[model samples]
Target: MTSPGVHAFLIIVRVDRFTPEEKNTVDFIKKIFGDGAAKYCIVVFTREDQLEEGQTIDDFINSSDQLKELVQCCGNHKFAINNKLNGQPLKIKIDQLLRMIDQMVQSNRGKYYTNDMYQKIERQRKREQARQEEEDRKKKKAYEESLISTGREIGRQEAEERERERQKEQKSREKEPQKTEKPEKEQYSTREKICGCSCHKYPGVIHVVPCCSGTKFPFSLLGP
Candidate 1:
């Protein structure tokens, strides 16, 4: 059944005794083909000759809840056949089973379960996972870069603040040096007289006399 797929799954059982394991066969098939397999299933009850006289398949199914539940899971499609029959009777049973399968196919819109369908679902799932991972990676990278940028800005601001504080401290401690200046010398006049004499008559005689105060007088200033 796994090589390709099938249009229907016939669950065969004996009408004389429907075992617990047999009742769960449809569930096992669903596990293999997925939940959609149930719609394409048909429960076929064999050994109809063992049934009580005037007992129909529906009457037998209604008597047991387990059988009824199983049939309902298969869209309530069920059939009974006596394997001991031959010729036209056996052919009729086979033809009826085939007709039921054809009706199911028509109800399914002419589509069959295939391995390709499962593969396509798996491929789509992988593609979606890859896309989500890529998006998450981009978001994480952007968040890291933003954090780095914020850290650099904070470091720059702190450095600038430290430099400003240092400059202010230096300015507060600075002072100008004091300066000293020299005094100027006194100037002397040359027109002062040393003695009380009128010496305006002298023509060229140059003299140097010393007064009592130790000051010097010229010869042109001596008295007659």
Candidate 2:
């Protein structure tokens, strides 16, 4: 009968004696079907006739913190029913329970409970997590690559700027005037020719003549 899936899980418990085991009932259901089972749960508190006069279901729920927490975990969906009731009263409570189940179905977007649903949902979650991680890794890699590329570009630009400065300095040096060396002073000899003779008489040079007399003169003496 349960091959297809169940729309609601009626967790019936006696209101007169809400035991500790009863408080842990929803937890057991979660253990079997998964945490999503809580949304489809409708807590049916049987034996509402035992409640003291003027003591409502809310009053009973508020009396116990554990019970209250459990109910809250089940989306606060609860119903009180007196099993001894007959006829239209029972019918009305049954109708209200059906309506609550219908509302729960609508809230769940017309989904039902199955073990396969939990496994499928877990698989989807894992797939989504892996996809997100892969995307993040790609983004990180791209960012790192961009940083390295930017650094290289900056280094290239700086090198180009330095080269330009060097070229500019070289051109400036080429445009500047050059210094010329002074000409060397003429050298003069201290000795000179003495007497006039057929031999060449050289100024500022000494000569011993083969004339009637051989003589030598200083550089200050001039030949006649």
Candidate 3:
């Protein structure tokens, strides 16, 4: 028979006689309560207690591998009880079982199960962030280098273009002609000559005069 209480006590009764329905009920109880079924203990209860009168619980458990395995699954906790009596032994066993539960709860206080997993996740996130930062740094450096190279190429082209324009201007100046200034003119006076006297048959003249101004000869005149 199973009873409901504030706290469940898992009592495993290893008995000689169990109906199929009772076995099924025990399986159902274990499934429903699970690990929350506290203060659990395995009791080897039987009407014939003489079978284990001289043997300890450990001795009997060790006598068979199946029994040893069962006890191990129950946290190696077992008790011998008389099925015909409800006495001090049962109370003492229950009290010890409760104390063991209290100790287990105390030992596990403030402890979590997923701490290692959380740490692993944090480390993974940091690694990924670092990888992304490195990639970004490489990309930015490559972009800056490309920009610098492009700027250099453009500057070189512009310098060559300026040099070409200068040369073209020089050639044009060489092909043009130069202009010069004209000189001034000068003035001069004209002179005239005349004869003073002439011989008709002999054709001899002794004085000379200017035709336009009437100037006389100075030295001698045969005829004036």
Candidate 4:
């Protein structure tokens, strides 16, 4: 089916097994074959024995949706193959089928499908496949880059959050140190001094004599 440069495409569709999938295959095959797919295409219906008792292939075509669509895709070109036919009748059907093929070839300027055309088609298909692959790679790279960018953004946000939390903790610690601090006491106090004589220093008050003003004496100098 992948072979290129086919002048004619014979779509073998079973008369009895006609289904939507078969009908859909017509469009798919055309895609695989590319341009000039329809002109040389033919729809050959098999299993003609399953036709209604008095009905011809046309009757079947008229009754079935899949058959109608198949015929339409092949430019209304359709034929039936019944191997059961023998002698002159079989020959006649064969001749008819050949004549139709001949007409199609003739219409195509007697150009039969050849390897040269196939090679050309194949090369073109390869080029297209390469292009599509490149495009897919680019898309994949873009998607990956987007994921990395998103991850970086998330990491940056997380780092900022951690820094904010750290700053908040530091501020809280600073306030705690202030709140738990004790009142400042004087390093040097004159009240710690007393007279060296028999005079006792007033309680919690500073009383310095003229002679002991320069002296740092303990209040125990006045023994009880």
Best by TM-score: 4
Lowest lDDT sum, 10 consecutive residues, model 4, at: 203-212
Q: How high is the CA lDDT of each candidate model?
A: 0.78, 0.80, 0.53, 0.75
Q: Candidate 1 — which pairs collide?
A: 197-223
- Tens-place lDDT digits, model 3, residues 1-224: 22222222344545445345533443443444443222243434344354556775566557766565555555555565555556887688667766665554444452322334344555766787899999999999999999999999999999999999999999999899966666553231122333444333443543345323355544343443
70-118: candidate 2 lDDT, tens digit per residue: 8898999998899799899989989999999999988998887865876
Clashing pairs in 2: none
TM per candidate comes to 0.52, 0.51, 0.31, 0.72
Q: Candidate 2: list runs displaced more than 4 Å.
A: 1-3, 118-224
**Better model by lDDT, 3 or 4?**
4
CA lDDT, candidate 3, residue 98: 66
Distance from true location, Cα of 52 in model 4, Å: 1.4
| Candidate 1 residue runs with Cα over 4 Å from true position | 1-4, 118-224
Cα lDDT, model 1, residue 33? 56
lDDT for 70 (candidate 3) = 54
lDDT of 4 by residue, 1-224 (tens): 33344557788888767667778777776566656567788888888988879999898888977677778878888889885889999999889998999898888888776676656777888999999999999999999999999999999999999999999999998787445678798554445544454334544444443333455465543433
For each candidate, C-alpha RMSD in Å? 15.8, 11.5, 23.6, 5.9
Best candidate according to lDDT: 2
